[model samples]
Target chain A: MIQLNISDIQHFSVGDGPGIRTTVFLKGCNLRCPWCHNPETVSRDTVTLTYPKANKSVTYGRSMTVDEIVTEVMEDADFYRQSGGGVTLSGGEPLLQAEAVAKLSQALQGHGISVLLDTAGCVPWCRFEAVLPSVDTVFFDWKTSDPTIMRERIGGDLPLIKSNLARLLRTDKGIHVRIPLIPGVNTSEEALTAIAADLRETGAKTVALLPFHRLAVGKYEAMGIPYPYRDTPPLPADTLRRAAEILSPSFTVYAEK
Target chain B: MGCIENFITGMQPPWSDGRFDTPRFLEYVFNDGKGYFHPSAGLNTGTAESITSMEILMERLETQLRAGVKEYVESFNRINVLPDPENYTAPFLSLFCKDCIGRGLDINMGGAVYPSVHGAALMGVGTMCDSLAAVEQVVFTHKDATIAELVTALKENFVGYEDLRSKLLAAPKYGNNNDFADKYAVWFVDFLSEEFMKYKTPDGGGYYTAMAANVSNIYAGHVIGATPDGRRASEPLSDAASPTYGRDTRGATATVLSITKPDYTKVACGTVINQKYSPSMFEDGRRDKLRALIRVYFQKGGQEMQINATSTEVLKDAMDHPEKYPDLVVRVSGFSAIYVTLAREVQMDILARTQQE
Candidate 1:
């Protein structure tokens, strides 16, 4: 069966995972964050790749074997070693293609290469359960602890996300909670303290502070869609630093990549 | 003028198709009595008094260029501000070209204290020079009688000298690559730069100047007259004050080729050569061999490159097929031109290079 539906494969990225990682953007997403940069990934169905100059084209990927995927990735393995970066599996949600993610991660791991899985914890717990053994680290994105805000910004099933978090905590995998602190939206003093508290409760041990940015504005124009969070300003760098310092005492809060 | 009889004479096809031949060009330029004549003028000597920021240069250049380009478009717009100033020289050169081609104006370029023109030449003078310069020389050098007669002729407005004006306008100038001339031009510039850039500025601003001169995007050249060498009329040159094109070998080569110490140091010497083939050869994968040739160029101590990077069919199509992409900018050897605006033979050279496949 055609298992993996990838949106993009970006190279020479310095701030994705550990170092310079090749972040593979898989196509279908489960949650819809208002400030999402890769909004194209949110839909489960395949769509045309659109350009801002009024051009549109089809996506280019086929169902390849685990070995075929590994071969494509290893071409830049030397760059990974030099830069202390490896492969970061991110997407609509890598967990959406759980079996493929599991197989691909294990293949890369068997080759002694590092792998990172970036996810929004709303997927079925069994999906993460299958991929956990191979993934070196899981960047579990958790935007807000307040269930109402979570549902409003991104159509999130917060209780299920928290429960999935609880299950991951029970296991021996490394996990970090990624909270994007958007001012007037999610970046309140209360949200920081509350997220710090929820992360501590999850026993995740690390929470990364993700800041908002305007880099995704062009993508919205390209897709011919009005971005709901268009007017939302980026969380100032100083504020994130201050928030990181504020939340540090609770659970090793660090800035998100 | 005394060495006129002693210098060895060479045969030239007095009639030209007006494409790319140096001897015909030389014969046409030297036909009658001329107002300006200098065999050996020193290199890189001018009067820009070395002001350091691009801000001041832009303020002064913008005013003059607006006047030069007033007749072209009805009104100025925001896009005309041209954030990219480096590509402005050829356009400026085009303005002087249109003026010289439209009237008999023997305007001397590369003279006096206009820093903007010097700045433009430093960009890439090889492609853009001779065309308009030839026209200016044509008007000033005609069936004249005495020294006073020539001087008086120089003062006449382009409209008064209608016959010479039309002849001047009728001639096409160089900006496109012509092998024999571009090669010789390096020698002429080398001669001028060596002798001219010897002393410090009269203003104590050292004579050593390396500036990026394409200041505006108006496609304008500078107005020069009665230079030390003998530029007598309002010679139109580029006023777009920024830098030169194709990296000047010196700027591109990691080493900063400046006039700080020894002048006219050979940094990265590059020239536009003639290619006989057209686009059909390259489209069939001749570019691989061309790429390999460049690899050898770097290996054999050559560095840096910028390509016209389009196919000949497209070039031929652009010229013959002008209705297709009117805004196509192809490298006319050193300078670039919007393909539709280029003359036929210039378009043919581009077609030949695309054949390198």
Candidate 2:
């Protein structure tokens, strides 16, 4: 009888994980990253996206039972089998609904579908422990090593996030540390070096550096919020190369451009 | 024979995927066919000229087509009777210059030239551009080998070059929603459509183009050499309007985004955007996502979409057990037919289409 607040269920999502995954983006987040691409999933309350360019709007946030969620994600069961892909739970922070998501992941896994959890790792260790057994892989976001920027810009508790990542790393679950290379936010050499040191200590194997894209500019417009990165150009290819050079020594780094 | 005519007439490979060249074959359509000089020979016109003369000659070709069309119409009318089959249909493209005349001199956009069938469109630039990015990334950029070595390897059909081929294949492909390769596809569409737009049909109809090649990508691939996208020699080119089979690694959503990047509004003849989803994706709840995906695509100016819900399993079953699937109909390009009736290779080709969720 448990219910989860879901924003949207994207089928055949390749970006979230390996193969053809169905990414269920749950609503609400603890962080407030200014350049958060999926702003709609950030708020727990239902929000409508009005696009003046297309003269249309779309509302996010729907309540669905665990059975309904599992049924929806299971529709691509064949794709999951053929492509080695499965269900990925992504959101503003999937760990925020740790209990419900743990049940959801277990349900999906029960159907022989691999479950990947994509989260910011800002939640408590108990949340990670609850979902770790059900999730086949964890895409942990490592925004910045600096605590000041984390708290001021993104409203994240660096100590808490780091502790959760450290705890998750100790487990047998497959883990990938994702770095969103936001220029002027976390692309600095010093910051990347600090990140590399932390991830190296945590025994990180693979690191995916996601370059900043302006794709979410429209999302901000629809919500009537003035985006902070409106005038900011995308992270240049050279910057990505430089960042990769810094991160490569500790882990097998690749650019997700 | 039409290929030979295109060649004898100095037209470059004007067929789907610029593979056919001026024929070197000596076979003749008529007794006097061998006697006529190649169009290039006439362009020389016994004149020593450079840039200006070439420009002037280029301008004269259009005029020549207009004149020849005029003479053909006059002759056809004079010789035709009430019962003449030619008079009824007036098949426009069989005659030389009709394709160009229909676009340049003709006013109607009704007739279409042989456009780049989806898979063969990359042939426009040959293997150079498509493979150039990969070569740059794998060999040159990575310092894996020199350009000369890579060229030699390509000449050898990548024999003993398994590592290099894999690296090239790993390079971003056209339909993977990666801007690196998809940009070329966008340019291919825009360049061809824009070029055709310059010509008008005789009836003032605008020139239209198509990416739908039906099954010609298979035939076209037979003549093309190994390409840079790591496609082996004699491998089928991407079919219909879809990307090279299985090259769209990002699944259906990304493929849709990449395929819909071209301005279909400029293409009056329409294009076919093919997607194959497993049978399960067509089920009640999941079918709505496919519909929404298509709705999003069309809303973004996509002209046409051709989706096949038949899974590879069903297709393979149909192949092995034709008696069991008498009514199993599958869409092949613009039309649908009994699955059992199609050629095995074609059936296999449809079977290989990347089936998504």
- Tens digits of per-residue lDDT for model 2, B1-357: 221111223121122222211110110111112212223221222221221222332233333323333343344334422323434322343345345454552211222343211111222221322454575466545766554455445556688887778778778776666677666566556655565555433333334355665666666565545555687766666764577777776567677767777676655455676678777666654555566666656766776677788878788889999999999988887678889999887887788878775
- Considering the two chains of model 1, state its CAPRI-style docking category: incorrect
What overall lDDT goes with each candidate model? Answer: 0.48, 0.66
Question: What TM value does chain B of candidate 2 have?
Answer: 0.65
Model 1's alpha-carbon lDDT is 0.48
Error of 1 at B226 (Å): 39
Q: Please compute DockQ, using alpha carbons, for every candidate against the native two-chain complex.
A: 0.01, 0.07
lDDT of 2 at B341: 94
What proportion of the true contacts does each candidate reproduce?
Answer: 0.00, 0.12
